[model samples]
Target chain A: MLIPMAKLQIAGRREELSAVLEGIYRLQGMQLVDVARDPALDVDAAGLNDANSLTQARLELLVARLDALLALVGSDDRGDSRLHGDPDPVSGAVDLADVEAELDRISILVQEAAQHLDSLTDELAVLPRYLHPLEQLARLVPELAALPEYELQKLGLDTAALVLNTSDDTLVDTLRRELTEVFGVRFDLTSARVGTDAIGCLLVFSHSDSARLHALLGQEHVRHLPLPSAYSGQSLFGALAGMRTRLDALPRELADAHQVLEELIGPHVEAWHVTLAGARAELEQLAAAAGAGVTDRAFAVVGWVPRPHVARFHEALAALSMGPLAIEELPHDERAHSTPVLMKERRVARPFGLLTRFLDNPRAASLDPTGLMALFLPLMFGVMVGDVVYGTALLLVGLWARRKFGRISPGIADLCSVLVFGAIWAIIFGFLFGEALGNLGKNLFGDFSLWFYRGDANALQPLLLFALAIGAAHVLLGVVLGMWQSWRDRAHRHLLDRVGTFAFLCGMLGLAGFAAGALPPGFMSPAIALTVVGLVLVMSLHGTLGLIMAPLELLGAIGNILSYLRLAAVGLASVYLAIVANELATVGPLWLGIIVATFFHVLNLALAGFSPMIQALRLHYVEFFSKFFIGGGQAFIPFGKSHS
Target chain B: MDIGIGLIAIGAALAVGISALATGLAQARIGAAAMGAIAEKPELAGRAILLVAIPETLVILGFAVAAMAILLLPA
Candidate 1:
């Protein structure tokens, strides 16, 4: 699926070069190849015409603005942009005197507003305490002290009583005398114990004088204990708590003010856009003036375009009269060729339309093995997972997650799909083989022992044979797929190599069957003959040395076949784990056993699911990919707006 | 039955542990280098992550091996 590419060198006049580069930039889907600049070329001058540079600069500015907006929104940061935007030429060149005057005015206004706001905030903090009734009572202390000659008359206690610590008795006595003369009723000071604390003095008042005392206390200028509930021991602490509550509500109150500020600042932000447009217009004018003579300049401009966009690029160049610009096709070079097959097919098919355009023009290699990988990966996974119950559980979990999450990567989605398939296969194989919970054929399916050999003693040979057969099939499929791809590409040499590989595989299979008595004694003759043919083709396609060692290649092919036995081996291991879990669950007392069963089953399910998933992917990426894949293709990257 | 099961479990665990350790060390070393490159040019983060993940296949292979051992345990 990796597109084959060839490097090209382009030469043209400066103006013509710029036009061609611009046309390339306008192409919808193209990957630009990074070519080293010639030392002789003036890079700075050439870069001015370089469309990629302009695009990169534009993208950086856009990304910076987005980042600023995100920061304003208080979103998490995605790091900083490395590309610096051009300075605003007009602003940059402005006289220092003008800038200084403007700055001074703005600074003075900001400082004054900040100070006023701070003072207002501080005053609001103490407003609540001043409003309290107890504070009102304290204000009356001084007024009462001014009066002289008072006598005790009342003993009843009500709201008129003003209590004070004996520590400040002089102020209390003076206040009592002043209150008595004002109200025409004696204000008596009585000492009484309240709770465990000493009550220094309580001013008793008649019901009629109570109203007057309350009125005197309500006056402003009192520094009294705030409401008992509001007293926080220290004035600063109470003030701070009140200030914090008010400040917390400030944002809501100033929402409209903030909106106005944004409105005022919005024009300044838009000015950047105006500046960019002006710069672009100026560049266009410069280009127009240069005319046909622009091509005669000393520098060369180069750019990349996608293969599909080549026609459009050519049309644009023709319209601009920018001919004589050389164009080269970039080849796809991948380390593993099969990995991109699905992505490539998806690209060509366009099944999802614009939604998948990003995949087609990815900036990174879309190396995802899908087709042959689809089959072997699941089989390997099922074998490793082994238990039907655990596999089923994993499948259900994957299905639920996929449905809930909505969007997920195709690789992971495909993996889940494969695991589900594997689970189905495991159920059939597990039941037939009497491997339920690793008890073999004893207790499970009591009377149905015909489907599989009972216990480890009877199962070994049959399982080994099954493993060998599966390995043969897997390897054969890989070779066949390789051959088909080569034939499709019309690469005769690659086709011959694939054929050689197939024949070698067949010969090995025949020999193995013969050794196991699955074939006649004379089977070695066909195997040897086919193997010789395979070797000759391999040598002709590769080298003379390859042909000489064709027999050894056959032996190597046999070794690879043995590798598939691991599939069966892993399946057996999974069954063993399930058995162990079951045994552990049953070892404890009844109540404990229930708990253990739940815990062990969950643990086993997790292990079973993860182990198979990883192993299955490994078999495909390593064993299968090793045979015929090269997957280091540079992904297609188009020149356009990038989402940060 | 107990001895056989114990031996199999021990062997499988050991293999899994060794494989995991080897993979962990390999990934750590490769990942550090990839991270350094990404630090220099953050645009390359995606590519660097892909490269770093390549070495992680060893751990996967080890996991597969352990799974194989477990499957082959006498039952």
Candidate 2:
């Protein structure tokens, strides 16, 4: 049901405004409307640009920081929904300064630890590049302590290193010969087997000829290997040993840093969340208040509050001791176009309410269709997926999901309830159809007493007729809902139009049956008479244009009814697929047959299950909702809450 | 099978096969647009699903026609 809202204007002394707003925050039931934009308010409102007013950017920054802190401590609640939590305490009672200081300290420590871990990991990653070639060089030449500058100069050389595949050993000789000719520089090169397939080569050339040697090497496609900064000024063995020690210690150091950060912050995660939530709630209230129009000494806050809670809201305001405060309920008629919508439903209907929110919230004046959809969607689903064994499996899965994930999210629990309801309907239809995973039960039981006729080719006509009848009833209900909406708005012409359309549909259906010789001769005359009367009535409202549109409306209604044939058609497909599975299984060896049957049955179950659920919802949204759902209402959002 | 029965079978196959192709073609476009819509706004998932399922009626109607054709055959 759509809850009625009463418009409220709250006025209080400037000094006591925060206290009054805090009381309203604790109530957490009013959606504040910006009174500055109210046409009734004077254009020359005072204190609109008050120096003391909090800026929106500052409020956002505070909220973001709190969110960052919550995430850092692993207590972020951005999209995760927990099914159970303690009710919120009253607003702005606790001081968050000490927690803020602790959060700041922990944030810095965590950042430092993260940075240190990153560098260590980076060092460990590149260690292999240096270690691999150096280990090979040490093994190939046992006393090649380091590159000797004197030995290097013997060939007019300075040191450089190159890595290559074993095939590229020939490329090194080419590089040496090419360099001697192109750069006129002599070179000495040493090669070591680094990895299984790759060789490490060290080259020496005259310092004066180094630049020419590099160009010549590039031309020969010889890649250079530069030693890491840590390896500089150390012998190959010493650098290799140093790198091994660092690599071994890095993992332990990273683990210890993680342990320390976790130990420091993990215990306080819950407290940090609560503190941050409190701070956010306060900041949100201030932001909401900043939108209100103010006089020299007082502020006026205009908002919409649920009608039943108006008195309770007043009582909370009275406790604030804001002297000579004015709290008045502006009639809903005053702001009909802007009234925010709040849907109040019973606990059982809550999940359907969530589903309704997928579309726009219903207008404040419009009917809430959550209850209607909840009742009908599952019934349609059951009819379209009639199979007892499949239904039972669905029920079990829904129950298991509800039990396992209910505490994690209420939305998921509600969705499971919808599935459970559909499963119940499925079981009912399954019995009616006498199906269990495509006649497996019939084949095994040999004409069991519990069986109804299988929904085979013979049952097609009656099932189609049944689906049409359901469509007719559903469309008629939509007409009634339209009339109810018209009645609420006191639009008598619209009421007449809806009633006329209903009569026209009835006459059209009656005429169709009579023309098919399915009805008595007596029905023909009255069907024609009803059609004329409905036509005249509809024409009276829409004038001559209604004459042209009336037949089109009837056609649309007929088309909608024909659309329900999917229920029968999809159900038949499921049965046929199940039969195919059984047939395939029987063709092979017993074990092989069982495997084939299981595979096909699972595929059929998935298709049959998901298709019906989606089709049922589509029928409701397109064929059903078009009747009276004029959605575009703003959802009621109360101030002083971090999330709705 | 009799010639009449064979013709009925052929008609049923044509009705189902042609309409199934039509449904697949329609759904391919609708499903892609629905996915793009859902990526932009996650809450649109329910409505997108309803839109994607709308084209399925083509196949269902074809199935009905096929069933009618099969019923023309003798038991």
Candidate 3:
């Protein structure tokens, strides 16, 4: 049922307005409307900018900062186990100065920690550069250190090492020859055999000849290992040992930095989320006040509260102040064009309500079709997919999906509910049609229908006729509902329009039956008489054009009814496909046949599943909804409420 | 003179095949636009599917015609 709303206009002293708004926000029932739009109230636009504007702006800034902090911590409210157990009570107004100070203090610590982590990351990145050379130097450090240190310095020499690991022994001899004989550079080549196919050599060359000798040995797969600037002129073993110690300590230091940052931020995440929620609630109240108009002494606020909530709204405000306050319920006629719509849906129908909202909310004064949709949509779907085996499979899949993903997304849960309902209908129709998975039941039980034949093409007439009957009933229901709405609104002409259409449908069906030789000849008189009366009634309102158009409307209604034949038609197709699959499966050996049949049945189930759902929704949205539903009302939004 | 069954087969084939073709042609455009709409707003997926399935009425009509052909054949 769609909830009826009453317009709530609350007037109170300007000073008490904040407290009143807080009380309403806590109640979480009233959907606030802009009072400036209400022409009956003499609202001062400039007076809206009260002391709350500056405070609201500050609160908005704080919320943004807190959001950034939450993101930085990489945690969301939904994933937290603590948030699931108990709901938080609404907090009192937070002092802006206190919140600003807290956020500022935390933000500074977070920035400093982040900077520390970044510097550690930067140092760790460069550590690999030093570590790679330090490892190589550590391997060859003793050999180079054993050389006469004074002579090494007295020769004004600089050192370069080459670790040759490639499969090129000739390149090693060429390097030794190039430095000593061909270049005639003062260089000492101290070579050490490291491993099979790898040789490590250290070159101590005169400073004047270092550039030429270095360029000479640059090729031939000789990798020049350069030491860090700090260890360049130091004793090779001492420098290697010192660098290795530093390299070993860097990883531990990096780990400590990470652990420290995590420890600083991890414990505070829950507290920050709660603080942010409280501050956000207060901020939203300030925003509502900014939209409302106020005077020097009193302020006026207009909003919609469901009729049942009127007493609660009054009681909450009364508790705020013992002094008399003006609370008036505006008449329904005074509501603005964009009145928010609120509905109290039945629990069973709540999931189906997702489909209704998928289209648009029903108009505030229009009839709600959610309850009817829950009944017809699944019925239409079941008729289309009438097969027991497929229905059971769909039921199992829907049940599994509901358990796995129901909490993750409301849409998935709604879809699961729809699927479960469709499957139940499918099972009922399946039993009636005697189809387990296509002709499997027919072959096993000798092909007899429990209610009516649906297995062969020759047996499709009954299904088609049944579909037409269903369409007639559905269309009649829509027409009756439209007439009821019209009667409620006291639009006699609209009511007449619906009644004429209803009469026209009866007359046309009767005539069609007579023409098909399914009705007695005597029925023609009443059929023609009814059709003429319907035309006259419709023509009364639509003028001369209605005389010609009313008959076309009757034909259109017939077409709409005939359109339901698709339900039977598609079901027949599914049955035929399943039969073909069974026949094809038998073309092979026993094991192969079993595999083939399973594959085909699975394919048929999938194809048959989604199409019926889509078609059922289409029948409801187009054929059924076209009769009465006029949606487009805005959904109700309570003050300070956050949509998840 | 005894070719009634063959003629019925041809009629049923034409009915089902041609209607399927027509539905395919109509759904092509609707499906493409629905996909584009869904890309912009995922909430439109349910409505988009309904729109895309509207053209399937052609196939249903064809199936009905084929069924009629088969059922109406003389024994």
lDDT of each: 0.51, 0.75, 0.77
Could you tell which candidate, 1 or 2, scores higher by DockQ? 2
What would the per-residue lDDT of candidate 1 be over residues A372-474, giving only the tens digit for each residue? Answer: 4545656666655655466567768767765664355654554455556667666665556655555623455563433663245555567666767876787
Best by TM-score: 2
Model 2 misplaced stretches (Cα beyond 4 Å): A38-63, A77-111, A118-210, A213-250, A263-274, A319-324, A333-337, A446-452, A490-501, A528-554
RMSD of 2: 5.8
Worst 10 residues of 3 chain B by lDDT: B52-61
The superposed Cα distance between candidate 2 and the true structure at residue A615, in angstroms, equals 1.4
TM-score of 2: 0.81
When summed lDDT is taken over every stretch of 10 residues in candidate 1 chain A, the lowest stretch is A350-359
| Steric clash pairs (candidate 2) | A156-A206, A157-A205, A157-A206, A158-A205
- How well is each residue in A298-409 modelled by candidate 2, as lDDT tens digits? 7877888888889988887777666778888765562266778888887767777877877668888788899998888888999888888999988998899999997788
- Between candidates 1 and 3, the one scoring higher on lDDT is 3
Candidate 3 structure quality by residue, lDDT tens digits, A317-371 = 7776635579898775512347788866788888898899887788887888999
Provide the lDDT at A165 for model 1.
Answer: 42
